[model samples]
Target: MLQRPTMPGYAAPQDLIRRVRRTWFLFFVVAIVIIAAALAGAEFYGRRSAIEALESQGRTDANLKVALLTAVLERPRALPLLLSEDQQVLDALSSANSQAIEILNRKLERLVTGTQAAVLYVVRPDGIAVSASNWREPLSFVGNDYNFRDYFRRAMEQGTAEQFALGSVSKRPGLFISRRVGSAVAPLGVVVVKMEFDRLETDWQSASRPVYVTDNHGVVLITSIPSWRFMTSGAIPQQDLASIRSSLQFGDAPLAPLPIKNPAILNPGASIVSAVLPGSGEAKYLRLLAAVPTTPWQLEYLVPIETPVASAVQTARLTALAFLLPVLAIAAFLLRRRQVSVMRIATEQAMREELERRVVERTEDLSRARDRLQAEISDHRDTEAKLQVVQQELVQANRLAILGQVAAGVAHEINQPVATIRAYADNARVFLERKQTDPVEENLGAIAALTERIGTITEELKAFARKGRVAPEPVDLRGVIEGAIVLLRSRFSGQLNALDAQLPPPGLFVMGNRIRLEQILINLLQNALEALGDRSDARVEITVTETSDEAAIAISDNGPGIPPAILDSLFTPFHTSKEQGLGLGLVISKDIVADYGGRIEVSSSDRGTCFTVYLLKAKT
Candidate 1:
């Protein structure tokens, strides 16, 4: 081997080899650490970005929901008024000749100009499209029948404004609003109003969602998303409709008429998504999907999220640059270390004179840690206090709700007898003043009978107000049923054709407070009695039947059957058919039944309305 010469201030060849090897080993270790750190940082950043992206998506969805709701709410509060105006138009059409109908339609066309409604149709109650804004066919809808629809029935039954069909008409999708024109007893007909759905569709202007409305059927009505008139025609493909039905459980059936909290504005599948829809010369792209059940229009908004491949490629390029820059800086520092070492040594000697630097850094770190711990403790205490307050509020609210239901039933029961007494007394007073001496005697007797009824009402109010603690003992089911009937007898005496009670043998007993059970019985019986209001020959049948573990009290009424829409929600709080009712009678009864480890159920048909309460049997 040839001898290698040594440079000045450098080590011998063997020593240089040893030093270089040691330095290379250290460099390799440092490089490995840097590579590991870089990988970990990249992974952490990626995970953090994903989480942030998800959070941002959630926020965007929430904001879109709010915006769609706001637009729907802003829709012409004048819808009901418009329906009323259409009633006048229809009324005029009923008597006017074709010339008059054409003239009136023209005037209406001018009135609703530039509005979301494109076409207005006045339909006859028989489902005939009577008049349109533009005259096309005279007998076009003359004999069309709409008698089988729930919307038509609703208008006739409730005599109120109602939403009807929301789909295609004359090759165009739209919404139909109708109002009963005549009396509640027998309405002349309904004033039907039709609006172009595209008008409603254009109302919603979201940039990132699919907006469309569905009828009671999962059929899509209107969407700002283009070429989606197929949904409005109620002709969605099977698979797509199935996907929508499964996710949202959509049905044409009307849900219980109870208050619905924030209903979702958009329904997925066979809906406007995954593809662009054609528009009628309006904006084509969609970002939000909004559907309004009140009308038959849905507004689809599409906002484009960045393409994943393009975004990924850009991100990777930036990431690579970030990684390469730190590595290049480390290599450059290493290459310049020799010259910098002497200056660093000098600088270190000068800076070593300061003793306070290390101490100050340690103190600052300890202060930061203490502040973080204190913030955490404060947050924990705030959460605990909020939870405690929520629990207390729930307890108080439950008590108040129960008390309110009880109070309403009591008031209703008292008012019935009081009303009868007032009628009798007023008749007696009129008889005395009319100088009819013969009938005066009968009226006086009626007044006395009415006074007795008033006394009964007072007693019932007192019993309902009783604050005594519940006392459970062996009690007769027949007695409870009869006592409740007695309290409510004045209410049903003449109103109902029969108040028959069929009880089992005297051995049927239940372990319950007599008064509370009586209250439950009265609630059920009163409901039956009230349902008999419109029946020609009203009757209520009460039967006591025994089960293996419990005794069942069944009350059946001959009034109109409970509405299918309301039957399920009847036991929920604040659900009632009566306009002035507190809607607590059935809810309180259910709670009482549950307390006894029993149940109350209802069955109804055209035959009558039947309610059965199952109570645990008392040991003899």
Candidate 2:
């Protein structure tokens, strides 16, 4: 051991060891305190920021839902009002002529199809449904009495009325929009449009957040969760429930409080709540509400907060440690360097070298800590990115679900054409075996025509399934209608006398795909024929008319007419009355007409039914 002397202000080795130990201990204590304080502050601030972000997200979702609901609900408001002012509606209401009523029914049906309304009808002054858009469906509202409905009574008394309730016939929830027709003093009943939110609710269900719309009484009328529909946000008074029950507003639903726990009001229209989801256990959420414009309803949005909060806390801890470790290491190095300088002045070089070695070790430890913190931050970012990608996939999956719904009807439609083609081919083979070339030629021609029709139908199906649009051209209105009738001739051979067709001049044209236009006409004719099943005097009349800018094709039939029960969803996909009906005929027809800047409508009563297709005339 070489003699080592202490410099000024430097103690002996044992004393210096004690001082260094105390200094290290004090540094740790202070560093821990500082880090703890910094972590505490950071966690507090981060939690606040996360909560704010959650609230912001909830608010944005609430507003967006409100806007969507408002747009969908408001669209049909003008429809009822406009139709109420129509001269034809007033004439139909005043005259009570079966023909005029049928015509008005067709007009209303067209309006419903064009506007995508659940049902459009004109109530007589006596509160009887006179003409309805679903006149051709088994659930036609025509001839059904609606005298007891609040919307009808209110529209009769207040000039206009709006009511959200379960339809008495359809047994589904919807908003009834009604406007008084004719003069206020001599009002000729009410014009009504029912709007269903099933599609809207389906769209909402695809979102990550929980969302719903509640009426004035806090009863949830629309919700992404089907089970939550008709649930109450808060306790409902017995009297209110009784009244709602008596009115048949919600149709025998158990109006229980929503499944939420530990609700704490944070501010107006905002709350922090805990809820147990279907698959997920209890979780905290930031709940927000926004009022729907022009409606006494509020949209609620809920966002999960636990994930963000936990992430914030972890981030804060890692950041505090990251900064604190480096500072402690630097402080320790400086202290060791000072000790080395003092020792170098009086002691051997070995003592200074030992102190320098400790400094390097401390620096390396801090560097390692820093690297770990950086790795954690990178992992956090990667997790967040993955979460975003998962959200996008969820959204895309929802869209695919919609496409699947549309495609469900495809099998039914294609099956019919395929069956018809097979039947025609069999008939042609039989005729050819008998050497009846004329009949064989006729059957083959029919098969060829059907094959072409199938091609057009498949093309339309492909376009719809792909969410693509088809180009419109000048289509011969008469030719398309005749082609449709020709397709139906074999099926209606026994009732040929019952088919009445009146066509416009040969040159009449409309802006649409010819085959799609034929498809629309064929659907109407087939539906009419089916409705006229087994009736000896079953009749179907086709009339075409032209205007300066539009061409109209009216198909009227004397069938039993549509029933009121299924009228509300007459054009909805997969809704049908026939055992084999796919319920997509009217839906596809509506879509085709809409794509071509045209519309299809229907009116029905006990006397008969009529469907009208309106298309824009081709420019010369």
Candidate 3:
């Protein structure tokens, strides 16, 4: 082999080989550094996004708890105010006559039968209870002396007061609502209604979510966990504790602070804190608080953060590694190819003229290699973009779809119990509202009214069915219009103000079943009402005009006119444009009119629609 001509300071191929080794080592180190940085950034971003979602969900739960508590507290407030105004309660308080006291006791029992109140009692001016709803029980509140109770003393001076305390006789805790009878100047006695929250607490506990309510002074008044009840939310001064103890409001139990500490505030009314809930070890919780309405109380709700945050951090790190590994691999492969190219150039340079010609070819090869490398890089970048899109899709699916499926199953299993509890809440409120009126007489009258309504519905159903058809009679046209409107008003209550009815002159009659003729008009009128749903300037007009042989009653509405496509089949059975209904009204109406030797005519446009019933006139 011919050797290259040597010149002064000429480089050897051995030196270039050593340089390629050094470059490869450097590339390896750089790739490691890039991977470490990517992991760190992913972790931080993932944790921040997860925490924001956690706080938002915690706030919603807090609001629901506050609303339920407000409903429970406001129900019994009516009891004391009503009793304070009763003449029998006033007479009983003024004089301690045994017969009047007995009468008042029985009356209180009747009043509290359907209410959620734990007890309803009347207190004398000296703070002695003379009548109680539980007067017949062994632990009756008939003779309990409430002179030491803050609710009784405050009502004596302030006309009305509210206090949450433990009952001395029942040894149970409840909210006591008291209102003074008569006036502050000449006070007769006090009316007291104690409302318990056992059912409310039970419902909350069943949800397995930690929640608690605190008074203005930060003392726990209601809680899902029994161990947390009567506990202070934070530090209480010695003086305040002493005053609370002297009032005997909570009895002799120790009021220690709740088992939560070291809160790091995340936002207003939200925090991350270490809490020890019952039946679980200590964990970090995102706590949210909301103020209960109509009361000086705040509710705190807690949600654990470990499981969700950890999942987010794990998903983020895996995605980062997945994106970086392919890029690093491509870099390594390109570096290896660069080393091979350098060695090829060195070998060619030993042959002088061949080296010159190969140099140009090598330049073109390098350009082509660069273009191929760029293409490879672009392909990898596109893959990385698709990977990111897939990761986001997976994250969204895992968070919403899977969680929603589980939630739906849980909701289905617990629907009945939750509905029953809500029904109880609704019924209690309704009972209290009615009790404010003349409850005894009004309740009996309501039962009678309901019975009469049932009978009326039965009679109407029988008439609509047309069972045992009656012979045709002289049906007055005016009476038919009135009856049809009365029947239609029930379905479209509060919407009849748009109706403009024009009745026929007296003595104008038709030979048809009275109810059947009414049915024909009812169907037309009901369709007009349904068509004019919620449209502005809605109107329905009824005109009764007579020809020489037939009586025509036309019903029309200023609604979107019936479509031409369906108008041809308007009276066909089971054909309708409405979203609801059996589509039998117009068909039945057609049959009824046909049986009476009558026919229907329809005219429609974009502005309005009209259906006129033509009936044979009777010789009246």
Top model by TM-score, which number? 3
In candidate 3, which residue ranges exceed 4 Å CA deviation?
1-22, 346-620
Task: Rate residue 150 of model 2 by lDDT.
Answer: 84
Per-residue lDDT of model 2, residues 330-380, tens digit only:
987787667656644544344345445645778775555546545754775
**Cα deviation in Å at residue 475, candidate 1?**
86
lDDT of 3 by residue, 266-342 (tens): 88888889999877899988888899888888898888888888877887888899889999988887877676566
The CA-based lDDT of model 2 is what? 0.81
Clashes of 1: 32
Cα error of candidate 1 at position 312, Å: 8.6
Q: Estimate each model's TM-score.
A: 0.35, 0.50, 0.54
- Each prediction's total of clashing residue pairs, residues at least 3 apart in sequence or on different chains, is 32, 11, 0
User: What tens-digit string does per-residue lDDT give for candidate 1 at 1-620?
Assistant: 11222212222335544555566577667877776666566655654454345335544653565465546444533553465445457555467567666675676566556455544445555555455554444434333555654445576677554442433325443445556655676455655445554434554433324554445444544445544433443345668666544433223322222111222223341111234334322321213444544444453334333343234344544685577768766785675465345433443343333223434667675455446545754775698689889999998999998787666666754554465556656666787789777776775675576466556544644544552224367788878876676556645667645677886677678977665677688778778877777666878888888865689888898878888889878788778888887786777677667656678999887778999999988853
Ranking by TM-score: 3, 2, 1
Q: After superposition, how far is residue 307 of candidate 1 from its true place, in Å?
A: 4.7
The lDDT-based order of candidates, best leading, equals: 2, 3, 1
The TM-score of candidate 2 is 0.50
- Give Cα distance to truth, residue 496, candidate 2, Å: 69
lDDT of 3: 0.78
